[model samples]
Target: MTKNIKANGLNHLAISTNNMKEQIEFYTDVLGFRLVALYWMHGVEGCWHGFLEMNDSSQVAFVFNPANKDAKVEYGVTNPGHTGGPSAPGTMQHLAFNVDTLDDLLNMRDRIRSRGYNVMGPMDHGMCHSIYFQGPEDTCLEVATFGNADYPIGPKDWIDPEVQELAGISDEELAKFTNPIEFEGQGGTIPNPGYNPDSYNPDRPVQLLQGMFAMPDEQFAMIPMEKRPPSMMSDEDRAAKHAN
Candidate 1:
């Protein structure tokens, strides 16, 4: 029998940024999200992480790395440039956040415009109405509100057969994709099957990768636990760091 486990919703969504301060301002000041956590990213050198609260449990996080400043952004490659455009495969084409109602969506649109940024949409997309805008560092932002229906989105009705054919998904493949099988529990019976160099490929050097795979999971967990939160740091400790 499959274990009774499922993921309910998002805990947070992390986006990489070169300018943490600018991203923080856009999320908090303009979008009215509360600043919750700001600290030096654990296990990473010279990186800063900030979180803007989306709800009590979920947040929108940004990571700032100095190396990103040297990276170039080519529209349609780095970013789509708008809500509907092309981006490199595996990249986040756009991020759409959820709101409760149409009124809330419009109010957010007004708030963004008041901050001197142009927003497009309040355009209806059948199941939801959305507003599109640009954020710092060519980030495409969207806010949407689902319609007040018993089942706001019907996947069966929404999935087009022609589009499915174009994507080369057969009936069996579509059924499997839509409804995935639940995993049976192993009850901690699996052994560490130590790393294999031939089977695995890493972008970084094998020596560096081997060192990481060699460490016990329990020992690695302590590395992040050593760093305290930004708010808890003392004056002398604060001087050694930079986070806004």
Candidate 2:
């Protein structure tokens, strides 16, 4: 374990959608998530974003690229679907939502079924009970509850012995992996010395901000936030513009 930083829990998960209206309908109407917000996606013209919330911090966000529509769904490639197999290097395998109790897990399963979607289980895995299903855009979804409230499962119980041996983890390394140094996070501005301006990844939304961050204030402001290049839009959104 690293002592550098600590993350509490998931804030939100965003996924792409071709049609904003229909996606909103599916989340709110079918899944019973409440529409939290809908607005133009900042720094990008013609792109819209919406949020459906299960709670304040737990949200399922959507991005609609109205200008492009021809993008094909890559089953087991772009999305993991039911199988939850490996795709591209950084592909999302699946998302598991949390419930507090066994009753809640059962209720969620029933709700999913009522929405005309088949969901499997309350399959007990000792520590947690889980229900598995699929969501819009072929995203694999799971609802799980911690069955053992007193003791949360740890790596010591689950880590494979064969894999550890293959990785050549010595007893010392295994000891460190099981019990690492802890630090109490302090308040105030922490310093980062190795930060690089050129550090950018195509997968994350923060990359958009990085480009703007490198520019002068005036130039950044003058950026064509209102000008969405055709290449920037989804294929379906592009087709709708030419519909005559």
Q: What global local distance difference test value does model 1 have? A: 0.83
TM-score list, all predictions: 0.84, 0.70
Error of 2 at 14 (Å): 0.9
Candidate 1 regions off by >4 Å? 1-3, 149-151, 184-202, 210-216, 222-227, 235-244
Backbone clashes under 3 angstroms, per model: 0, 11
Query: Which runs in model 2 stand beyond 4 Å of their true positions?
Result: 1-5, 148-151, 165-244
lDDT of 2 by residue, 6-59 (tens): 666777888888877887887787578898778667666677789889887789
Q: What is the lDDT of residue 219 in candidate 1?
A: 72
lDDT of each prediction vs. the true structure?
A: 0.83, 0.74
